[model samples]
Target: MAELFARDTLSSQRWRRRLVPNQSFTLGRSTQKYPVVWDKQISSQHAQLNWNGVQLEIRKIEEAANPIFFGSRPRISFMLDPGQHFVIGHTEFLLENSEPTMPLPHRSPRTEVTIRPEEIRRTSFRKTPGRIELLTELVSKMTASTDHDQLITIALQQLLHGIPHATDVQLLEQSLDGDTKTFSPIAWDSRDGVSTPGGSSQSLIENATTSHMCVLHVWPNEPDPATADFTQIAGHDWAMCIPLEIKLNQVAALYISGKRARLEGNLTEVEILQDDIKFAELVGSTFANLSRNMALERRQSQLNQFFTPGLLDHVSTDIESYLAPREAGLMVLFCDLRGFSAATEDNIDRLIPHLHQTSETLSIITSAILAQQGVIGDFHGDAVMGFWGWPVSASENPLGGIQAAWEIVQTLAGTEFLCSDTPAKAGIGIAAGQAVAGMIGSRDQVKVTAFGPPVNLASRIEGMTKPLGIPLLLDDHAVTQLQSHPSMPPNTFLRLGSFRLSGLRQETQIFTVNSGEIAWLPEFSQALILFEEGDWPQAISILQSLPTQFGPRNLLLQYMQGFQNQCPASWSGTIERNTK
Candidate 1:
């Protein structure tokens, strides 16, 4: 074997190449074909060198404008001898014969040095050039990868390049469940681009558990009972398997096969050349860590999906902090499907589909609420409660809730009903005030919820929607906040008369938005203003003149007509609710 030491002047970098007998290698700027391509003033196919066993021949392939020099003289072809110099552009090379020669004797008595067997082994291992570089390149590739399967594939490719005799490489991952054990191939590579021992080689995998490292001297040609199936499957003369200890009682094996017999010291030579065992261990540990991290990330994502985004961030940072109770100003929203019960009554065939549609509608509603930074609190039979300002505060909770409610109403309006004759519809109520929010319930079954007047008022208002024939309603506090909010326009809401809610003493002012394009809103608002100002006759006249669609369903109109025959002496327009 002969060696060429190429040195660069500008970068002060050096590269070494071994010249094999009767074989040619190129040096040029094309890295795909040339082994020693560099950023120099050289042609893509600059030169080629062929070693004919004893002597070395160099031929210039490209006619360079600048002369190619051999010992400071321009030459197109020359036979390189030991210690000969050649130059191509700014790069220089020196030829050196690596033939073994006898050691020269010293004139004086030199101290006899003894090398231990381990030291000799270590020295031999280090002398194998590119071993460290190969390991570094493999590690770089592994670290840069995020996917576990891709990492294993990269490892197989690197192994094929690092181990010269390795004709095929396969990684087998072992999985254990109770008394059952299974091995599956994760990645593999072969010189002929066809995987050996493929997926059908289960018997070979079963045998891998018997030993940490297994070597087959005569693989396919002389098959033994222990490895006959594998030998036939792989069709190789020699093979080795190294087990990587990933965890306790769990291992993944790296298998390498070749169609060549092992000469004396061949196994040790292979070990010294590439350190295959260490590489296998690295592959196992890297993959194990990556798998663990991926599982953790998946679990985190699953947990995050269960909470509102604002609450999820807090939950991820600290569970206790997120669960801790705190007083906050909030806007609570309650929404319930109107005809869900009737849609699924006494109909088991339609029950599942109805439930699916309900779930989908709930998902759409929750998405709208969450989009406005609201946290979903609880779910009843056909209702869902959501609130803003718990884990984090919104700039304007009332406006946010109203916007979310509007979006919900719009979404349901366009949604096709799955189990109903009519399009699906829902009633939503929003109330804004101070509330206590936190995780509540037993240790085994905890729930994040809000408590106080705002939450209760929102629920009551939602119940009122069924009788009032309104899709969305808001309380006095929410309307006031929305009016004062910087982002909300003043005319967003139409004020309804004040009413005493069921089970509540104070009269709560109610309001509703023009969810659809209702042409009677201006007249309705004038009637409400007249009713509030004690002009019952004028209010009754405006109410009677309005469309009948706005009469029976309108709570205020119903109250006014009930008192039309005999008006109260001091009516304050406060309609009291008898039931929730």
Candidate 2:
């Protein structure tokens, strides 16, 4: 029978489907047909495979998002001869001529026990000089491999090489979820060219896993054909399964089988010696530790997107201590590109370049936050939200957010990121207060973010930057915190004035920093004080006296003129904003 054998290169999973002569089959992610789940790279209708009486013909269909790779080059259509294979996404599909057979059950192990490292005496294990050299070479290969799949493949190959009589060696991942247990093939190598060697004894594997030990089973020579357990060890005489401890939920095992006839000697049922078993156990232990380290490194790489090296090191030691949700003091910062929308709209023909430009701009903001040891919360299009003091108290560096904001302004000023173009501008807002901060979301998805009035106030202050004619603003709390902190630089913090933020009841005093070109700061401060005190005449006089280049003074002059040169009766020294 003709069949299509599929293997997931990363997961070490195998799936096969019998191909009928002159019949068409679809291979992709569509539920109505042959569905390839979990891989998004494959389109719903990725390709079509047709197996005629002579050979198999595979063609890349139009719906495939990614190309079908034949070796390194992509092929739109190709004839798959016997033993030919092609790759789509992470799955490799091959055409085979052999008829698939069900795996035969294996006999129970006569002796299974957890092997103690100290119990394995050196006197009991003996190896030739050539065998020792082979083991050394295999160990070097395993140590150099960083990927789990590659490591498993190397371990299997090395095990097969070390045990010359072994017919096949397989690496299997055994996982327990709730009451169900699963055994999946990770990698396998055979003395022959077979990709997946069959006739593995389940009873032996189960015994090794249950006891977390090494199981050795030797079938009797010339055994009775009527016994049901006889067929379990049909092809091989003796087999050994060494359990590799990876984790509490997931355990792996190394299964090695050998046919006594391959030894070319008059041997009994037990040809697998203590030396061979000991070597397999050693390789299994090395694979287990390396696999665990690889998984941790991959997870740490993902976490690096949100945390700094220092914070991530702490997080790695005790995740529950930092990730648990709780109320704590922190500083939150909100940063946004000033004219992103207009810039994107104006360059609609070159939107991709503009998007790349936006990403580059956002990278600057992210780098500044991480440099200050702040955690990135979320990104909203052109805006980025970051916070400090969760997992760790912000009492040590309450001015981190402030410092980051200042750094962003200073960094953006030197580049074309904020050129003469209106859309190239940026705005930032910072606030410090107590809030519930930690991982927030469902079981499927979660994010570390702060939720409280201070968070809202920070966003409101960011919005106020445009209307107030300033590039950056901070709430009064941030200013107070910065005042107490001795780490502040020589930059001037100008008081913008008090205003009622949208959706916030209490008025928040706004302040902006003189990071650049704020000429006539004293005049602007004088005008703001007079305007807040309802001294319209003197305030207008001082505001007019200041340079028109001062945005705050110009904005104030416009506000006073709108009231016909008189303070309104309802005015309470606070500007009321209707929107954020």
Q: State the weakest 10-residue window (summed lDDT) of model 1.
A: 101-110
Alpha-carbon deviation at 40 in model 2, angstroms = 30
lDDT of 1 by residue, 205-303 (tens): 344445443322323355555534433444554444555544233477766656553434445544432344344444545555555565566656644
Candidate no. 2 TM-score:
0.73
**CA lDDT scores, all candidates in order:** 0.65, 0.74
Predicted structure with the largest TM-score when compared to the true one: 2
RMSD of 2: 8.3
Per-model TM-score, in order, reads 0.48, 0.73
Native-to-model Cα distance after best TM-score fit, residue 300 in candidate 2, in Å:
3.9
Cα lDDT of model 2 by residue, 1-580, tens digit: 6667666777644545556799898888764335566477789888888898778888889867799988678999988888888988888888877631222465454444345544542435444546667668776876776556556666776777778778778777775568877566555667653554665777777777887767777766556667645334446677888877663236777888777634434533343356677777777777787777777777677678888987876765567566878998878999998788888899999999999989998999999999998989888889999999886778645777877887887766432221123332678888889988888888788877778877888889989777765667888888888876676655557788888888888999998775555456677788888899899899999888876545667678887888998999887888878888
